[model samples]
Target: MSDALTLKAMLRPKFRGALLGVAVGDALGFPFEGSSHSFMAALGPDALHAFEAHRSGYFPPGQFSDDTQLTLATVESFLQEKRFSGKSLAESFLPLWRENRIIGRSPGCSEAIERLIDRTADWRTSGCEEGRAGNGAAKRMVPLGLWNYDEPERLVEEATLAAEITHRDRRAVAGAVAVAASVAYSLTRRDLILGEWIDAVAGATAPISPALARHFRDLPRFLSMGEKEAVAAISKLGYDDPATAPTTLVTPFVVPSVMTAFFWFLRHPDDWRETVGGCLRSGGDVDTIASIGGGISGAFNGIEAIPEALRETVVDRDRLIDLADRLHTLKEAVRSRRGA
Candidate 1:
């Protein structure tokens, strides 16, 4: 196959893999969101089992949460506009918020999007100072990276715009930049060493947040800290009380959660089951962690790398696949127009 064909072939599977991987990871971790690791350990070998062991009524077994829902919306926006635009993002995001039933239940997220829709506040200055930096921004950034896979700088720029729609805080933007950069780097280069990939992400995200910039700068040292210790270290970097200080507390959680997930996938590159499972087992912000991990792994391994059972169970799998294809087409359109 020609290089172009090879690159295009890689796009479909990575796109499908990234979205489906997120759904699978989200569903796997949904049942244990607030539960402690010890409680999960009490469940025996299959500690990270599906919803059968943990009940979430109305939500189907493999259904995703706000993470995948927002991601889908972002992908849809890219398809509609062929490039990232804050106004277009807000237009696309509000409907998904209502359509996915994310409002009321997820107050922080709902409030953010609602404000954008109502024009009560500009996305650039709307985030709550007390709002904890949950993984909300990072969870939805895969599409930005996937949409501009060939242009790492554009991926970072677009991902930052997508993130600002809901999370305008510096920390929130930093987390999105890191994840998006990772995805873009993974997509463009096949032979990247894991540490080198992490470094590249850190470098790309340097302008977003000093804390995040520092975190990425020293990531090589942290990589040896092991998953549990690393998570604990990350959790400590900020208060986890989302209700008390939403932005201040949450930013800490998202940075480490995204980093931990990326590292987990790096450690287990070939095993999708273990990679996704390790993300679930990492605890605290389970869905977000898994979403990040799944996206990275899926980007590196492709759709076929994901398990058959998990892939089949993703809510709206066909629709997500179609969306990915549409995003790819839009990307090509943008490239063609720019060349013209």
Candidate 2:
């Protein structure tokens, strides 16, 4: 059944769900990040769903990595100024970088933060804007759609600016637009068909770069395939760079990480548990793929749909909820000003 629940007036729960979902997904894959498929398989499904017991030395089991940290930072930027500001978003990152909180730094993002601190380069110029595209731009963009759900053009403009703080590649900007747009639509559109949803995302994204155009072009074939088939197909597409020896799935490369995440979410949209756990099961960059897929699934299904078992394990559940509520109240104030 299509969700009859009106979403325009009930953005709080969905917004909370989206951010909380990101954290949940990030935590899920954090332990298995960079592990080989054989390693993950040996860990088994029991380990995949195990909470508060991460093998990875970096975090305390349920704790999320830089993905959720930056996502929360993005939410904070809006709350701090009572509105969205790219400079604020870029500024928010510096503290994390300086505090040694970020798990691994994207060169562009790190450079942007450094430049922001020294007042040497503007956020626009400080970005490591080589032709290379990476996951840094896309991993933390969930809050952009939550804040500006009503405005796609504005979302595109704002998201691009925010992304340029670290990743200037047109492909990175395009990928961010696609993720933000998908989240934007979920906030309002209840009867979302899988194909049309991706088409809308691809349409908005493809115009920005040829690389993403090709990536999006190949996405639809997975629509009708089984989960295993879709995974295999994505692997064959070879979105990751081959030159990098011991190429881990948790690559900073934008294209494969995105396609892999989207394949899992699209495969099982209705079940939030499987959607997150399934992506982690695929291994390699487990946290980021799960974060992207989990956020989207959470936005579509609402936090209520999340299994209590999994929800119980998420780190800082109340804090995530509070951040979402703050964004909701701020969004309402903005609406009141316009008096729609």
Candidate 3:
């Protein structure tokens, strides 16, 4: 509660804020995945099952789906290995699948996991033909940036490798790269000077792939546009597939998923709560959108700003905080080794 807290104290909360923010957003948005903003708002956040119970009878309340599970697995891998390896991270994902711990995994990811376990193909060729570009690749990518913060080239390299483990499409890789760069750059400071933040993320992300490089170059134009105009401009990319009959609120495509999340994150650069509210209002794939957006926002805001009620609603507070602490310790160790 003291303003006198050191940056070290502040950073532990920032670390925990990023991961716990992911979990809170995942749980809060899970039940509303396919529902529109208007419909969900009518029912309210509390009505959506904030507590851990079975309104759905299949997924328990406050239980995060595939996004947070894969993220934690990725973090666990880093904690064990001290660096990123796509094979090691992918192997870590296997136990979750085997134990039925991965709820709501995309069909593409599920197929790839099956092939991976079969040992029938290399990871680059193992991405399922269908849904190759779902936000699945990008949704869980923030931890990469946290591990390799301030190292743009390394962030892009590891993020691309992480995405290709289950997502072969160029767009999926691009989305993952952009988000990871944003998370990495975010941890470098806490001030929300909006232009600097977007520029930092764009610079970190732009060199990854030609497709993403071009996309990030044009990111500022969209981010600077009016909310409705930005969404309209982004929709021109066809990520939402609105032409499909019975259109759902969310799309699996990479273009709009990353753009929309970026739009809201930039808009609410300092408010995790407001950023999450905006993400939920944007609808489709709400959990994924909110998780990435909230994680970034929380990275800037730190954990103290996260609502106590929402914090309590998430399932694994202690373990998540411990994981954050471990990651912070690892980062300090690496920094010490470099300075030595």
On a 0 to 100 scale, what is the lDDT of residue 99 in model 3? 86
| Candidate 2 Cα outliers beyond 4 Å, as residue runs | 1-5, 41-44, 56-58, 236-250
Q: Is candidate 1 or candidate 2 better by TM-score?
A: 2
lDDT of 2 by residue, 140-223 (tens): 888888878887788888888888888888878887877888788776665668767777778778768767757766776876
Candidate number that wins on TM-score, 1 or 3: 3
Candidate 3 wrong stretches, greater than 4 Å: 1-9, 41-55, 128-131, 209-229, 232-248
Give residue 60's lDDT in candidate 2 (0 to 100): 71
Per residue, candidate 3 scores C-alpha lDDT tens digits across 1-340 of: 5543465567777888889888888888777787664665566555333544435778666777788998899899999888787778888999988888787778878888888888886766666553467788888887887887757778878888898888877777778888887887667675766567656666655554465556555767887787656655554454345455123244556776677677787787877777787677766777888888878877778887678887776878788888988988897788678872
lDDT of each: 0.69, 0.76, 0.75
What are the models' TM-scores? Answer: 0.86, 0.90, 0.88
Which regions of candidate 1 fall more than 4 Å away from where they truly are?
A: 1-5, 41-54, 103-105, 123-125, 129-132, 238-252, 336-340
Q: Rank the candidates by lDDT, best first.
A: 2, 3, 1
Clash pairs for candidate 2: 250-285
Top TM-score hit: 2
Q: Estimate the TM-score for candidate 2.
A: 0.90
